[model samples]
Each structure stands twice: as C-alpha cells, then as structure tokens.
Target: MTRTKLLAKIRQVFPGHDPEDVQRVLDEYAGPERLRVHLAILKLCDEDRRDSPRHYVDSACQDHRDVLAWAESPQQLRPDWFSLSVTERAKVAKADRQQYARWLAR
Candidate 1:
C-alpha cells in the first residue's frame, strides 16, 4: 500500500494515536522482506494487545523471535485475518512453510 493509504489504515486501526509515532513505527517495522504492517497490526489485535502500534513494532523488531512465535498462535483467530490481501497471505504462508522446513532440517 502507498504511504498515504497505510497512514489512513493505521489511523483507522489505532485511533487517537499520534500520526508521527505511527509513521515512525511504519518506517521501522513495515517492509517488503520483513514485517507487513497490516499483518502485525492484525496479529496484535488478535492477541488483544492493541495498546499501540509502536509497542508491537518495537517488540517485533527487537525481539522478533518471540514476536514470530506469538504470531504462530494467537489467543483467538480473528475474522480480520481475511482482510489481508491474497498476495500477503500467500507470502506469509510461504514464509511459515520455509521456517518450518528450516526447523525440521535442524
């Protein structure tokens, strides 16, 4: 998504948060080969931990292993999971498969 649309989505998902902080979190966490911003936010929401996007982004960046493990098992699977685009879902699913393959290879 474009920066403008991303900003709008973040504002919609995390109302009352400072836009500056949201942008910073986006810049730090969201990337093509890294965390998908929408996925992170959806995961956070599924875990009922939507305190702020910054908190999620910080933990995801600094303690990615734990964050990824958390993503593997949400407290409850939310319908919002369907909100992800087909490409995003496929990418994450493929990543999961690769991760599991590596784990199995170990």
Candidate 2:
C-alpha cells in the first residue's frame, strides 16, 4: 500500500489518462485512502461531464455543485474507505463508485 504501488494501479486503470491532476491530489495526501478518494473522485467528476474522450473535469467549471457533491461523498465512504490499503483502495473505489454520477448529463 505504498504511494508507488497505488500510482501504478491508477495508471493501469486509466491507461491513457493524465496523472498530473491526480498527482496534485497525491501530493496533498498522507496515504492511500487519499489516493483512492482522489482517483475515485476524479473518475467520477470526469465521467459526469464528458464533452470529450479525455478524463478530466472541465477546466472551465460552469457547474461546480455536482463535482462538490461528488467530493463530499468520499467523507461518507471513509469507514469502508479506511479498510482499503493503499494498494486495494483504488481498485475498490474505481470499480464500485461511478464518479460522474453527480454531474449534470449534458
């Protein structure tokens, strides 16, 4: 459950996706759950608003509430969230949680 392993898993899950923004999340985090929440949240946020094939939240957020709520859900997910080690956390989060659900379907 180290950061390196977690990052590798993330890359596997999102082969072509950029890690820069996700890296931002990792830098702020002390451990794996933070990484889990970030990837889960990022996937959720990106999926909710897919104007393109890429997986990033709109750089220009005309609608912020959806992403905010999506962010909030992770707080509730912490108990189950904490159980996951840095390694399994992302796999669990990415598979179970469909992040983009919070956003408005355009």
Candidate 3:
C-alpha cells in the first residue's frame, strides 16, 4: 500500500492518536509485520473485499494468528517478530521453517 493509505489505515485502527506518531511507530517497530497484522485485521473485520481469493485471505489470517501466538509465547527466545529488524525477521522465519519441518516429520 502507499504511505498515505497505510497512514490512513493506521489512523483508523487507532483513532484519537496522532497519525504522524502512529506512522513513526509503525515504521520503526512493525515494519512489514504491520502489513500482515493489518491485513488479517482487515480480513476479519471485512469492511471491504480484499481482492484476493478467499483461500489466500484465509491463509494469511491463519499465518498472522500463528505469528501472534509465537510472539506471545515464552518459546520465542528472541525479540518479538513484529518488532525485529529485517535481518532478525529473516532469522526468525528460518527458525520457523525448521520448526514446521520437524512438526511435519512427527
């Protein structure tokens, strides 16, 4: 999404707050994670059609929930994935891949 659209969505999600400050926090803390979380929220809220197939949107929603569960769990030894830098997010994604592989093997 464009910066303006993202800022507007952030404002809508967090009303009565400064949009500039919200943008700064999102840029610094959430980064790409913002898109996943926001998309999941939008899908669940369903104020508009997301222009994606229902299955694709459902998968995104599930992935977002998994990320949230991981972030909230003590097993997530590193920083919260949402707050991590791009490099850190990559590392976490790698670890998650391995974990999923192991789960599948069981």
List, residue by residue over 62-89, the lDDT tens digit for candidate 1: 7655555555533223456588888877
Candidate 2 regions exceeding 4 Å error are: 17-21, 25-33, 45-106
Model 2 Cα shift for residue 13 (angstroms): 4.4
The total of clashing pairs for model 2 equals 3
| Candidates 1 and 2, the one with greater lDDT | 1
Task: Candidate 1: give the clashing pairs.
Answer: none
Residue-level lDDT of model 3, residues 1-106, one tens digit each, is: 4666555665554466676764443343343466644433433333343322244334444565553343233234555656888887777677766753442233
Clashing pairs in 3: none
Which segments of model 1 are wrong by more than 4 Å? 30-35, 42-49, 63-106
TM-score of 1: 0.44
Tens digit of per-residue lDDT, candidate 2, span 18-102:
6554565434433334444444444554445432222333421324444444554544355677766876776656644453333
Q: Rate the local accuracy (lDDT) of all candidates.
A: 0.56, 0.47, 0.47
Better structure of 1 and 2 per TM-score:
1
Q: Best by lDDT, which number?
A: 1
User: How many clashing pairs per prediction, in order?
Assistant: 0, 3, 0
TM-score of each: 0.44, 0.29, 0.31
